[model samples]
Target: MLRAGQAREDIKVVSFDVDGTLVSPGFVDCVWLQGIPKAYAEKEGLSFEQAFEYVKSEYDKIGEHRIEWYNIDYWLRKFDLDIPYERLFKKYEDEIMIYEEVESVLAVLEEEGYELILSSNAANEFIEFQIEPIKRFFSHVFSATSDFGEVKKTNGFFARVCEILDVKPQAVVHTGDHWVFDFLNPRKIGITAYYLDRARKRNVTDEVRKEDDEFVISDLSELLDDPDC
Candidate 1:
């Protein structure tokens, strides 16, 4: 864990993932899942729980195709639910909350002259709601849907961020909770990476468990106390 006042001169920019990294209870998949499916089930004379189970089963049937069709609007249409996007957006808006320590840590990093950017897999509407409370801490926010048309793990996504930030991949540090999506992929592109193990999810793979250029911290507060941060 990194302690505060530990300044790394070489690191110029910091990129972060929204859901698990910045938020406390983490991002709710149910906002889109249970919400849309339950609405659809009601039209079909089924309970919300039954609808969720059926939709989840259907999702399993599709396997990896689930990722492609997992967006809010996609699920709504897939379940034959006719609710407008605005209503769906508003319903789950209050549920998106940041982790208790995130704001203060972000403030300290910003005070230290680190350029902060958001790199998230969430939809624009969802991302918009999530960042509303802490928008002042970031210089920019990039959505996987609107900015890259895919997740950060995709090829060329990190490259695009480097180009946009006008920095080499080696100069930036990306922090997130997911080992595969946050740490490993960016580290492959020559970026310094940090794994935020907030949920205490262990890395089962050798690549993630091994310490290379990657740093692991249980909380963002560690950054404020570490000399190497």
Candidate 2:
């Protein structure tokens, strides 16, 4: 359903969440699940399995609600690893995996004249490294945690993005996999938001079906199916 360059004037900007939206969870999983634990194992002289257990426990203590939980440098320093954080980035550079439909979707939206932006909770360095191939498609990249000192779920982050972009909440469209952070949070401020549940594992679409059936999509291409998006 890709269209010609005739973007709707009302929808000025289209924002994307990085992980699990444009990019697959593979690279991040490699970073947190494999790379960190492997480094911890080497530093502690422990088995990888044992290091994984301890690292996961420490991560849980901080929890996803905290900014440190998403920071690679913080974790590297906290674990007192012998290796540098940049090493992990270099080693796992090959692991970055963007979703298949991401380029096509971005191209269509860009061709339609919608200003494309990436607003993520991920660290800025990680975001920059991962999106190298598609970076040209986006005019701005805002890291909520790295830039705003707030997570994506916070209204402050979204509000700050709107202020910087000089657009109202209603003029934007956002899509991501997280139900609360991507869907509810943006909608709270009147942004047209879609929950991109690629696996169809979430019940968000059903919950919103009565009002807006397109609230949740199982594929990025589905965004093109909606005229407003």
Candidate 3:
């Protein structure tokens, strides 16, 4: 347990994004980039390459950070694809796996009595069907579409989440892989943000350019190792 002063310094609420943070993004990549394209090819009688190009063209128009881009139902309806997106995601459910250190880290945090929240832009059905194995660990699971109808890329999303959790922004710490959505926006609202850069990739958002120092962790285990985060 954290000492009195330590508890005050430590985050009261620790939030994490699902994809590319708690879990590997391989399954989502496979579904959107590969599985859907193959299905499109079969449905449209177009060659795989041609179908992929068509889907990518339409997908680009929405832009990834937008709420519509992350909406599986919207994509299915827009693309006119007869197949359910949830079915496609479940086909690759085995691949939607959590990192090796994820369980251990969450266990430690839970033992330490931090309020853990799983914040993700993923469809609620996707969370229910794909990452269900790890759902037991989180105190609350928040989906952008189902929970708030908003994407985490904006400050409003953070504000809404803080309101739902009934905690001040300064008392929370959010960690995720996206340099913009997860790290920058939360920090803008006074939440402590940690970028989980497992690959050590460079992501210089406007805030990083100005502050010149960004909090980052290559592994979830690093959170346990840090005495002062």
Go through the candidates in order and give the clash count of each. Answer: 9, 0, 0
Local distance difference test scores for all models: 0.73, 0.84, 0.78
The global Cα lDDT (0 to 1) of model 3 is 0.78
After TM-score superposition, the amount by which residue 129's alpha carbon in candidate 3 deviates from its true location, in angstroms, is: 3.0
TM-score against native, each model: 0.84, 0.90, 0.84
Clashing pairs in 2: none
Pairs with backbone N, CA or C atoms under 3 Å apart (clashes), candidate 3: none
Model 1: worst 10 consecutive residues (lDDT sum)? 1-10
- Model 2: runs farther than 4 Å from truth? 1-8, 204-206, 225-229
lDDT against true structure, model 2: 0.84
Winner on TM-score between 1 and 2 is: 2
lDDT of 2 at 200: 81
Arrange candidates by lDDT, descending: 2, 3, 1
What's the alpha carbon RMSD for model 1?
3.4
For candidate 1, give the lDDT of residue 161.
86
lDDT of 3 by residue, 1-229 (tens): 3222123465688888888888888888888888888888998899999999999998998886677887777877877889887689778877877889988888888888889888788878776766677777677888877788775556788888899889998888888998888888888898887888899776546446545343777887766655665
